[model samples]
Target: MTNKKIAVVISSIFIFIMVISCSTSNDNPSETPVIPAVLNTVGLIRNDAGALNDGYVLFAPIGSNTTYLIDKCGKQVKTWASSYKPGQSCYLLSDGSLLRPGNTNNTTFNAGGKGGIIEKIDWNGNVTWSYTISDALQCQHHDVKALPNGNILVIAWESKTNTEAIAQGRNPNLVPTTVWSEQIIEIKPTGTSGGTIVWEWHLWDHLVQDFDASKANFNTVASSSKLININYNASATNQDWIHLNSIDYNASLDQILVSSHSFNEVWIIDHSTTTAQAKSHAGGNSGNGGDLLYRWGNSLAYNTGTTTQLFGQHNAYWIESGFPFENQIMIFNNGNGRTGGNYSTIEIIKPPVSGYNYTQTLPYLPATTSWNYNYGNPNSLYAQNISGAQQLSNGNVLFCNGPAGIFTEINSSGTTVWQYINPVSTSGVLKQGVTAAQNSVFRSTFYPKTYSGFTGHTLISGSTIEDVNLISTSCK
Candidate 1:
């Protein structure tokens, strides 16, 4: 699922709720429709018969508020709830639910039973189960992920007590500065006491304020204004350093790999350990910017001049098993460098030394093999952030564009095999999980009342042939 760009002070979940219904796009003057012409690589994709370019892809438009499960031809199989505050994340589950965080027009949402619950719905949009995480407890972010063990994972922020919050860098002067701590939560499955906390990880505990003030490498003005210390809430803190934004599980290793937008590092949480199994973190510590096991890109080495790196957050995934290039890790560097960088593209990297026992420094993304998409204007597609790189069955990369609201299938020579844009209705694409419709859109961000749309989804296999037709889908 895609993550929204929040400045990091407000509870992310609150921001998640806020953006869904934001009419900011109204402020964006409509520009001429730029029909996607073939990039130089389009010719190569035309020849790659394997790229999946069949059927239709549907999405919830940013302001439309309705989830339209459509076909490649733009036929809407279903449309639901013309009311969900339009946001950028949503997911399809095994139980036929469209998962997404939503906002309510009513300020008293929970009492009205119209907002804040992780609602599961049927194809008809009937609520099956709604898990209302206490808003006071969480500032939810861009997406929600379901765990294989029967729970869900959220990129949420936990509020701190007034006193304890102050020590963690909060400015007492700012009344409602909740002192948000970015975290990963594993919600227990049903049949248990509400839900069990399988595991949890917090960012503040492991940070080191090593950003040398003398050499602060920021482009923004040296604001003469007294900055808030929760600046742990600062952009780089959210982009290259600490707050973990995206997560994926390696069920094989019983480990979790998380992408910290602020720290620009990916970590593997070994769940095999029976210890509290919650909140403990290893690897790059926010202190001293020490590399936990291995580190690529940049770190908090301000003294060395190689300060904060990997500008912002995106996808860092392991090569799925059974692929031609198995075992190698693939990451999509969305190019919002923490401080600054040149190109924005997908980079497929291999470990300098590949084996078992993946460590922090295992796969160093090549400074070169990385691919960038320059949409003509020397500096175009200004907001091309957040991309997911998948090693497709056809050996192509199914690249999702978070800002431009498009997904493209590209071949090795950096060519676009096939492409689809998010309808003005749908804006960003996040961590896509399981897609059914051929040339389908898989979203990891699932919320309640999501079953509003979703009639029958078509299934496409390798961008070449039509595969299975799922009658009715369900989630556990």
Candidate 2:
């Protein structure tokens, strides 16, 4: 009851309360830091549990001439320098070389995804071999695939004059001044900088159009689904008609898959055909020569379906053997004009194959996607163009929201486990806390540590591409 006794009791209660409060704060820290209204941090953003850590990501910034290989922690492992910026895909080859398309700035075939040269550079930055496909009449662009036999498959724009287009049954009213048709050329590398075109397939050769009955290639549009309808998306001013943005080769079946951006379709053609046979409707293993053996996405392109499944999509390719969903195609559905509202999704479809040929169906088989991923909030993943997705060995999906220069990896359950933002912009490396801009990446590819390309090379990890500060110390 004394004054001293009362003071001691009050002091003990105060100390006990303070101790409990400190313990609670220390035990239950915030699960995730509050993100800024505008994200300014670059490089590795997240590397949560469940991410495939035994891999490196390879990416070519659209604004830079350098291709980078970085670890999951955002440490640079290696880089390949080029004289020209990416035209815009790059790949690390099994023999410790970089294969990339360079934007030689071809004025004649000036369009998106324009690449006039393909270069193979050794790990030590030596240009081992280079091939030029740029010219007035035709120019290589977009993607290329290295064949198992040391050859290359290239996608190019083959120009056709208005007269030439109309002669092939293109509607006169829709014919452009110059129609940039597409072609796939298989190049046999003879020596450094020298390549022989051993085989080529032209889109012009397998055309069918209902616009002009008098034309030699005229046929019912829906019935001749095997052939490209020359008038489907023809425009009076848009010369880049069949804008094929990606090319993938399936070695087992000897077929090539190409994504037609303008048509909103993914098509497969027989690669086993000879040049002569490819120019006709008969001769390849499928007995259809270079005619499209399988086509999907927008069945409306062939007048077979009412709903269009893909909108301005990109990076359509077959899931490689030995990986989950092998042989199925995975696409970055860009969702440019998606009906419900623009949103992006990584989609996979199992094409019904019957020994090198797709099942004969009105709108192609596998009517819906077997698997697809979008952020719980779909809009969070939207990218209007130039994005890509791939299934990693651990069943995680790696993708790039190209326009945002953001790369994300999600596990099989659609949970984000890893993420990174490209730090190099058109002006070079950005500083942390500086809003990332002009740093778009066409795509980012995941190469497992066991990749043959990393063999015999010492991969020394270096600092992140961007300048870091205290705010990003946790990432370090």
Candidate 3:
């Protein structure tokens, strides 16, 4: 009832409330900062018992003008120079010639993944042949593969008009500019800088649409759901619907395996058909012509949405026929938006084939992957884009976690035997002390020491990244 008594009581209540608030804050202290996955060094991290494939690693940076062939120790054995920035893919031929895609200035098609040129240079760094594929209608982009008969298989974007896409049942409001579908073209190089189209396959011809009954490809997805949906990237008009990233040829089966990154599937098409026959569904050795002989990964794209298989995967290909895990399909399963979190996985599946078509149930399909590599910790090992995996001869797998700039090899039992961080850094990737982002490689492929591609060329000894000495003649 006194003034002093009232003031003391108010002071006590204020102090008690402040103390409880501070305790609650302490109890929920900010979570520990999670370390990101990045690599800043080059050379061996752990060469447990040595490398499985004793040879060279060939890779080109995403924004560079040079491609290097380096030994297992990361020593550059050879180099190929070009006038254009490197594309996402490159390769070396058995005759010591290099095949690579290069970027060119573009003003026509406003899209991503722009590589307008492809060049072939000999081991001596001479431009043997070059060809330009970028145009108003389409442009070469991500990947390329050299065929056995001296032709190159290139992936490009074929433009679709706004009116045309809307006619195909795409939402007009969702279309910003125009739609770009994917295409595969086989080009035979001619004099110096020209090529002739020997064979081609377009995705536009093999699409399925159910949104419009009056459209050319109209059909209920539930009735006949084999073609790709025409309305995938419904938001951005400049977006690519079917971004095809990697391409591989199966010589024994005369088929082609292509990775459609945007759609999350790998398509196998017969390469044994004539150019005219490839436009239809009835002519190749498999009797399917340009139609997909086999398709696997995401069924939701085809309307069989029971279970999702791949999450924006990349680089799906068949293992080399004679390798230890030969004939099995492999993928750089960039497990984005997965149940747990973002982590990359290597999925190898022996497709159940009964003749030409894939053999599997409608909803459950294939049932399981033959083998895979997700290394318990998926978050730290995730690379959402631009990566690959290869099954080696000694039953080991070599893969590039592109985003982290790390290349690793693991045995059949999921044990890491060899590891290397890319030491070479691109223009903006150089950090003060961190080695996690020194450099990034889209893919790194291994070559045997005795591979005929290196037969006569003398490999030099120097730093992991060195200048080439092309004084000697090439293997050819």
TM-score of each model, paired residue for residue: 0.60, 0.91, 0.85
Better of 1 and 3 by lDDT: 3
What is the lDDT ranking, best to worst? 2, 3, 1
Q: In model 3, where do residues sit more than 4 Å from their true spots?
A: 1-40, 109-112, 236-238, 375-379, 428-438, 466-476
Give the alpha carbon lDDT tens digit for every residue of 1-476 in model 1.
22444445357777565544331222322321222233211111122234443323445544445665543322244545634553235556655676665544333212211224454455667655545454665545545666666577766656555565445443344424334455666676564125666666655443333233332322222221111123433532222224444566666655556665554555554544433423333222221121122334443322222444355546666677876466555666655642444455555545443232333331333334333434232534333344455666546666665555456666765666555444333332221222212122222121122232233543322221112111111101
Give the top-scoring candidate (TM-score): 2
Residues 229-258, model 3: lDDT tens digits: 776545654567788888999888878899
lDDT of each: 0.44, 0.87, 0.74
Q: Report the alpha-carbon TM-score of model 1 versus the true structure.
A: 0.60
* TM-score between candidate 3 and the true structure: 0.85
User: Cα-based RMSD of the predictions, in order?
Assistant: 16.2, 5.9, 12.9
Best-fitting candidate, measured by lDDT? 2
Between candidates 1 and 3, the one scoring higher on TM-score is 3
Query: Model 2: per-residue lDDT, tens digit, 1-476?
Result: 99999999999999776544432412222233222223337887776767787879999999999999998877788989999999889999999999999999999998889999999999999999999999999999989999999899999999999999989988889987899999999999878899999999999998998888898888888998999998888789999988999999999899999999999889999989999999998888898898999998888888887988888999999998888999899999898888888888889999999997888888887888899887344547789999999999889999999999999999999988888899999999998888889999999999988999999999977777887632231222
Clashes of 3: 6
